[model samples]
Target: MGLEADDSSSPGETVMVVMDANRSRGNVHAIEWALRHVARRGHTVLVLGLLCEIGKRASCFPFHMGEKLERLGEGEVDPTELEEEIARKRDEYKSCLQPFYRHCKKNEVKLESKIAAGLCPRKVTVDEAQSCNTCWIILDSHLKKDKTYIYAHVCCNLALVKGKDVVTLMPSKVILQKSSLKHRRVDDALLSNEPITDDQEEKSITPPPKTCCWYPLAWRTGFPRYFTQSELEVITSGFSEENIVQTQDNVKVYQGQFQETPVLVNCFSQNDERFWSMLRILSRVRHRNILNIVGYCFTGSSMFLLFDFPFMGTLEINLQNDDLAEKILWKARWYIAVEIGACLRYLHEQCVDGLIVHLSVCSSNVIYPLGGSAMLANFMTAKCLKDGSPGDNQSLTHCLNLQEDDGIAIDVHDYGIFLLELITGRSARCSLDPDKEDLIDWALPAIEKGSLSEVRDPRLTDTTDDRLIHHMAQAALLCLQDLNRRISMSEVLAVVRGHEIARPGC
Candidate 1:
């Protein structure tokens, strides 16, 4: 059994817990003792129990173990049948636990239960825990092991497992009823019917403290355990407006540091919750061209993120600020393409969620480093598309409406904008008289007439890479077609890589 605490829990406050249902009644007795100790301290308790063991079958199967027997004689069935069964069992389990649920409800002791099917239990648990104010997890001492994999039996993969104070129930050492489950260690002053005052927050239980390991070079992947507001304040010197670089859409960027390492502080408002949610999801991903989030701070009304500083700034800045454009020579342009393409590939193939659309993938969102390399940043507008079809036009409508759908069409549209910048050396949006604006529309006439020269950047006169430019422009124009006919990121990458300029290290 293990316990977790929010910043404010009293030492003896009761905590909500989750456990596997298969555990013996004796095990439940031990957990009861632990819960009593927690409750005496003034906090309430809740428990969630699983009702089924879910596993994937080669072809397909049903959800409920009991009901699945009916389909056992059959070789296989539709995958949807399996999913439907799982959903049905989950509902039935909820009904079966209604008695306990009602008892807990009447006593003000919150409790929940459900069944989930997936190869990654830890991931599923983490997603669920994030939605609750769960304080701890109590699991059987039996260590579920498979070869080198040791399943995290408690807290599953919920971020709470990162808490330093996590308590583990060692099978050999713990005797549930035999040992004294003392309630003396808990403090009672923190619990109150009244809302928690701002002053009382500091004393609230801080997520168990964590040790940080600093590095000069960025790690390929991994997120910091905790990013406290105080630590960030100290690093940014109170985030004085002098350090402020930019602010838009509820996101504020400030300059800061950890020792000599330059960093950018991202502050967001309530409307920007989706951005933070996207970050939490993306934190699990890693790629050379995708800017990695170092740490994050989430407090009521105030949310901030920390990331490594890039010397070269964003592509938007380079396009608008003439002086910066000179620095982005042909070689730098090639590197950006390679890196961004690699990022798209990783997001498409490596992530379990399938496709990731950079809802706002204009040049402005790509950042370049002075030393070299480029990264795709600002995913607040990004979306995860389960099925990898980029030609689904409705995807754009979904993003605009804040609904869920395959965002491949959105990605193709953004790629078209990126192509325009590469060819015209201009922003995706026109600054020319507003009436004459719109890059896609402005270039459409020339592109359709086959007048490639009218759309080519004059600066490429001496570039031996003209053909490379031509091919990219063609690909870009093709992607600009109707959503039903737009090419996929995979196909676009192939055309870009076909250019001689994109040759290794070019």
Candidate 2:
């Protein structure tokens, strides 16, 4: 097993990377880059080597590949066969990881290694990493030159299952390893489409925009300034536990004020490495419904991502009172649906490239305003197109094509779940009890079975907006489909936007 951390361990300090040991050479390079990047800033790193049997599990090897090979040779079945292969592969993989381990060790880079044997390498790696407060994951793209998906599917599967922040480093298109791979230039995908009107097309097609780096302009010119620990402490009231608004996967969110502006402090568990990339991505994205990243602090190995504090907190808390979810008028409910749809539209179209998927969108992440509107937060579990990298044009094109169907579809599914949450005032996947293992699981059965009114929140039942309710119910049904034939965001938006009521065209 790769390096493992026990229960009492800090969560965000160590960076655990799970990759194919057979591709240890490429992974080793990635680990080195991570270590150097983190170490230069004085952060510790952990590299986990997961050794998983391919095509079959360790138990099946003898019966499958080894037994066949032996029978062809006309030799006796070797009982020690599987163990010998495991031992040999383990040794070979260890040797491959040794050089990088030694380099980090020599530099006092604070690195650790662990080896794990399992059938579900990706799940096992993610599970093991989660025990130590992993906040971000960096994966190498598994696409070969033929444009056929390589390990990209593996990485995507892991991301989909885990719903965490993951960044994939792509290969330069010029170094095409597969002759059949078709990489489109990024500009053609992001700029040439011209989503803006004719008058605005010139502005949209202009030169590339400036990169939004977090460091201040003065610091970019060499005048660096940082918040002193003592100052930060006073500024944040000593990171007061009472300031904490929510906690998820070892991340504690605290509401505070920085220079009289509302700020939410996200103190991560120690082992998370994706903090930088997460912060970078969130900082660059601008959307009304999405939570805004105001500023952040990276002190040693720890990070505190500061965001615009959502005064309303989360829908989970708001609905717990029973009054807000039920007492909120139909107009307010419709307003929320419309606003959230608008937010998704912005994420789909207004971004530099194509769509950015909020892989894990749920009630817990939906923050409602005490008055005005609601917004989505928790980008620690989001993914976006590569905007400024060398092969960005190609990546952008591929991402745009992918968004044409896949990305938007996934988002529509997520938003449909959100709609269900709004209607039922319950989680999409509930675990409180059998009665509520997600509103979808419970209400969906009723919805399918024709208990229309019963499946809806009693709060919304009193309202006589049959067409709107029917449309929303239908949209949710389309979204809940496990197949790719689910409704698209544009389609959902069209239905929800046009059917829903707005106050006197305001």
Candidate 3:
């Protein structure tokens, strides 16, 4: 679901976490709460470590430290020695937070750290929070001593995590909300110091998969809402004709408003069957590049679903409009390729509940948000490996997992078609002319013949990056290979990003 305007949850917001890098003690609970609850895709978690002033010498600072050191009867500290100390301090900070780096990167959220020397924790935390313009700040109760001062002076939402299961949120000046959850047991799988992949290792990212308590596939506090029938009507302006933006597969889509933000309202009949199926899959999935359901309404003989309307409209819209077409340059198209591949990877491998098959993936179904990253939407034909929750129906889950599945092949193949469209600009041109040859028919031969230049979009001939194009074509060809030898989305994503994986050559 898209974030609400005035809500604490929104895209591109920062969550500032104040922790003392000295001891790893009270930070586990506070950081765990921030990542598991408050942070998600399109957000950044900044870990600010404000060093205490306990034995710090004036000679440790930059300028004139040499004079002070000389006056103290010792020569100036070696520049190399100072650098080593800073580096060790940074490594200490990274080790304390290393276990969670895998979680943030996997979810597509940015995880960053800063080291600051300060005299007081309160002043340092407030100054950093203000500068970062963060949406919320979670403090390790052990590190912050002056809670009353922080609560009054901090500019954004503040949370004081006192223990493993308790969090006190200062949502407003007049109200303080406290919530408790089951005692968290950190999974070893998530905390492993496994070596990172080559590309991300320099940044101290852990590449392996991490999950918490089965990733909370079951209904939780942050899941989409169930809007009443009246609520849907008010948002859609009583099904006004002018608001009708599209009609597809017997459903009417209306442009509407919810929480002062634009949204798409989809109306379906009671017996459509697709509604329940879509709801089941969409409810269980969340990714930065996958369009999510914000709210849904089911009443009487009609059903409705709400989605965050892309600020830039569908991919087809952007590619066809003359003014917008120029914006989808080769770089953007390459970015779109990587993003959609990652989105498919999440749906295919990361959903612990069950495998999801998005039956419809095309230019029309792809949305372009303001950030220009493509989001896969329109899951009316989507399905989960199990029809119901695994907790309630374990047999079904086991059965689906044990069988030979074609859903992955189908999605991978569709993604290959998408990559072709990206390079050739076939989707846009084909939409305008009904008689154009199928995208595969038009480009597959050139790709097979190793004539990539023949298939590149005319609009990008001068600006295209040959290296990325080659990698994209390689990944696409891998995807469009014999279904029996089809590649996985993770492999596809790696290739698109110019990584060479021993594929059985995928």
Candidate 4:
């Protein structure tokens, strides 16, 4: 069993306790005693039971018998029977753990249980211990071969419990100091119910002190600051609907104030693996054109990413409103387009690690901050091109050569659509006319034929500069080229800038 003491005086330090479902009653009793002791100290317990003998399937099958059975339609294994076997094994483990569950409930201990199948108990236990951030491990002294391996590999305090009362302590050298002997002796006394002297009692009542290196590590690391669950709850006002700004797929964006500064909170459900991966990516990336992560929270299974709130909201909202669209003058529109292009270029070429593709680069995902340049948001769908991970909605055709610049060509395609929307003042997916629902299909031909006047927004014709309109249309056309012939962002930026310079101006 693995047990962790929180470095802080906080009560919620997670303690991982590894147990074998098939262990002897004596070993089980000793582990139970250790769990109760830790639970009373205000640490949460995570019990992981190894199912060593279950889930073994035959490696080899007789070809002739298998063929005969397949031909007769009677050789196939029943799925129901396979499920029943798994259920039976799970039930057996659950039954053995019933007493521990009842004990935790009786003592009001925060406890969780998991069953894992593996032949190597040491490897399984070590992996679980590391993942759970275990501060301590309690093992049965009967463990012979795996004991030394677990001791050397697991980065935590180790203890071996034999019979009813024998406990051997091996503290982690990296975490404990020579002075820790006093703390160890005090812990032993507490476990043995020995009367404590005045000095020892005073030490015990004091808050558990944080180690020296903890502060430096947290300060130097460029990782997002970890916020506690309580802080998040208070900031989001218990995640009430009134605080919600937007919802994308399973993620909810809530508006909250942090230290009197407005912030946007992106909450992801426990089951979303993307949340963890995105955190890693966000830590490494910081750019003026990309929305930055202010902080993050990991409480149990749920995750929340805090970002600087975009007070002006999304580009889509502006595009759909006539008054807002008027405020976005020719220069502002051109600036927005150029800024978004720069953002994509930075993601693809300038990131420290490797190329990143913002798969969902549509109008809705582009945010216009109150006093800043337009920036890209919603990186949940973003992927590092170096990893060759496909975007959520990308097809086989679109994902071709993702490690190369061509892999980001699909994003170029989407950006082209954004340009078309900017020029025509039409939604990419919807339009007032049913016949013109898809902007690309309806406008691409006109745009390619240099018929800028025909596809330009009627609302923009009188107010926008004619030269700027023609230049943006031409650039959008270049971005919408055939997949094999599409222009790069560098080239598109050059063309757009060339037009701006060539126009008559002071």
Q: TM-score for all predictions? A: 0.52, 0.49, 0.58, 0.51
Please give, for residues 400-489, the per-residue lDDT of candidate 2 as tens digits. Answer: 234445666677778878877776777665655676466667777776665777766666556666555656666676677554574546
TM-score of candidate 3 on Cα atoms, chains taken together: 0.58
Model 4 stretches with alpha carbons more than 4 Å out: 1-224, 387-403, 431-435, 462-464, 499-506
List per-candidate RMSD values in Å: 17.2, 20.5, 17.9, 21.6
Q: Which candidate would rank higher by TM-score, 1 or 3?
A: 3
Positional deviation of residue 155's Cα in model 3 after best superposition, in angstroms: 12
- What's the CA error at residue 15 for candidate 1, in Å? 46
lDDT of 2 at 80: 64
Model 3 residue 84 CA deviation in Å: 32
Q: How many backbone clashes are present in model 3?
A: 1
* Backbone clashes, candidate 1: 11
lDDT of 1 by residue, 1-506 (tens): 23432233343333534444433321243244334333333345544444234433221222323343233322223556556655665555555545554545555554444444444443444444445543444433221211001111222111122122333321110111122334212211111112323122111111111112122124312344458888889878897888888888767889988756678888887546565556644666655467777787777767777787877788878867766676666545654665576577667655654556667777888986433556788878666555333433421223333333346666767776787786777887564557657788877568667787797665555577665666666667666755556355666676666632221211
Q: Which scores better on lDDT, 2 or 4?
A: 4
TM-score of predicted model 4? 0.51
Which candidate achieves the best TM-score against the true structure? Answer: 3
lDDT to native, each model:
0.52, 0.51, 0.65, 0.61
Highest lDDT: give the candidate number: 3
lDDT of 4 at 367: 87
Backbone clashes in candidate 2 total 29
| Residue clash pairs of candidate 4 | 1-18, 2-16, 2-17, 2-18, 3-136, 4-135
lDDT of 2 at 86: 48
- Candidate 2 yields a Cα-based lDDT of 0.51
